[model samples]
Target: MKKIGIIGGMSWQSTQTYYKAINEGVNDHLGGLHSAELLMYSVDFAPIEQLQHNHQWPQLANKLSHAAQSLERAGADCIVIATNTMHKVADVMQENISIPIIHIADAVAVKLKQKGIDTVGLLGTAFTMEQDFYRQRLQDKHGIKVLIPDAPHRTCIHEVIYKELCHGHVYPDSHLAFMRIINELHFSGAQGIILGCTEIGLLVSQSDTDIALFDTTFIHAQAAVEFALS
Candidate 1:
């Protein structure tokens, strides 16, 4: 099996989920004692968050690029950033690495297309939601329509992600609020809601809404496992 490299720690909460899910997925598929072969470079998220708030993407890209190079040297066959928002700088990071970067947006879009989903509600950090770099890629490259919540709702969701979910706190009240947002998307023509933030599945899930739920965390991990096994 090829070794998968993960650049995680945007929040340890979701990173841990990735670790457990990837291993469980591999074991379930192969049976017995099989588990994912992986290496992780968990960065201190404080600096990354600082860079984001300050709009210092160049520095952020340098950080991830260095992490990617280190993982490449350590024998990772391919790379996974393991976070959604950080992917704003994924290109800069991947350009210097020899291994393939399994981009989360591409992975999610592929899964959506295979299921015949053309439009999906996308919820994530404000950056991922509003940025053309991420949304346009899915639209222009994959022929997918990306739906984002409106201004006030967008702020609410972004706050919940950082203040609660990423902080390792899960509140029922927050899920209730998230459910309303999911329904808004459904009523607005979304057939499914993309859990675009890596940590979002830790909060809201398919049970929260009747609409189909596309969990990016699961989709991205499944893609990694397929690449590893191939």
Candidate 2:
């Protein structure tokens, strides 16, 4: 198997999920005693979060590029950025590394297309929700339609992601709030909901709702396994 490189710890909680899911995927594919062959450069999220909040994307991109270069030099075959929001700088990260960085949005788009979803709801950091990097890729590159919650709901989801989910805090009230937003998205003609934020899967899942829920953390991990095992 190829050695998968991960630039993680945008928030360690979701990074943990990526690590676990990728290993589980490999083990499930190869059976007993098999796990993913991987290397991870876990960054400190505090500075990264602060940069994001300040809209210091160029600085953030440099940081991510450094992490990807570290993984490449250490013998990782490909890279995975562990968070959705940070993918805004993915281009800079990719430019710095020779090995490919498996994009979370592309993985998600493939799954959505397979399910024949034409329109999907997105939930992530305010940057991801309001930015063009992610949604434009889905729409322009993959012919998918993207929908997001209204401004107030977008703010609520953003706060839940950083303040609550990133810190490993899950509350019933927060889940309820997410559910309400999901329902509204469904009513707004979303064929599915993309848990664009990696941490979101911690609070909600397919079992929590009838609308198709695409969790990028797991989907991206699964895609990494496919790349590694191929």
Candidate 3:
């Protein structure tokens, strides 16, 4: 199997999910005792989060680019940024390193197209939602229409991700709030919802809504396994 390099620990909470899901996917595919061949360079989220909130993306890009270089030097076949929001620097990371950065948005987009989902409501960090890096990739590359919550609801979703989910806290009120946003997106002509943040799947699932929900964490992890094995 090809080695999968993970750029992780943006929170460590959802990085744990990526590790689990990727290993589980590999095991399910290959059976007993088989698991993923992976390398991880986990970062401290405090500094990263500070950079994100401060809009210091150039520094963040440099930091992650160095991480990708380290993984490549250590023989990782390809890199996966474990967080969705960090993918804003994916191109930078790829340019600075030899191995491919298996993108979360592209992985999600493939599934979206396969499922014939034309329009999707996106829930993520404010940067991922408001910024063009992610939404534009979907719309321009895959012809998928992207919708995000309004300013207020976007704030609530962003807060829940950073304040609660990143800390491994899941609250009922937060769950209710997300559900309401998903419903609103559905009524607003969203064919499905993209749980664009990795930590979001911890609070909500397809079981919680009839509207199709795309959990990017698992989708990206599964894509990593496919890339590794192929």
Q: How do all models score by TM-score?
A: 0.98, 0.99, 0.99
List of clashing residue pairs for candidate 3: none
C-alpha root-mean-square deviation, each candidate: 0.9, 0.6, 0.6
Where is model 1 more than 4 Å wrong at Cα?
none
Name the lDDT of candidate 3. 0.95
Per-residue lDDT over 1-230 for candidate 2, one digit per residue giving the tens place of the 0 to 100 score? 99999988889999999999999999999999999999999999999899999999999999999989999999999999999998899988888888998999999999999999989999999999999999999999999999999999999999999899999999999999999999999999999999999999999999998899999999999999999999
For each candidate, the alpha-carbon lDDT, in order, equals: 0.90, 0.94, 0.95
Name the candidate, 1 or 3, with the larger lDDT value: 3
Find the 10 residues in a row with the least total lDDT in model 3.
Answer: 92-101
Q: For model 2, which pairs clash? A: none
- The Cα error of candidate 1 at residue 158, in Å, is 1.0
lDDT, candidate 3, 9-87, per-residue tens: 9889999999999999999999999999999999999999999999999999999999999999999999999999999
Residue 80, candidate 3: Cα error in Å is: 0.3
lDDT of 1 by residue, 4-88 (tens): 9999999888999889888988887899999999999999988888899899999999999999999999999999999999889
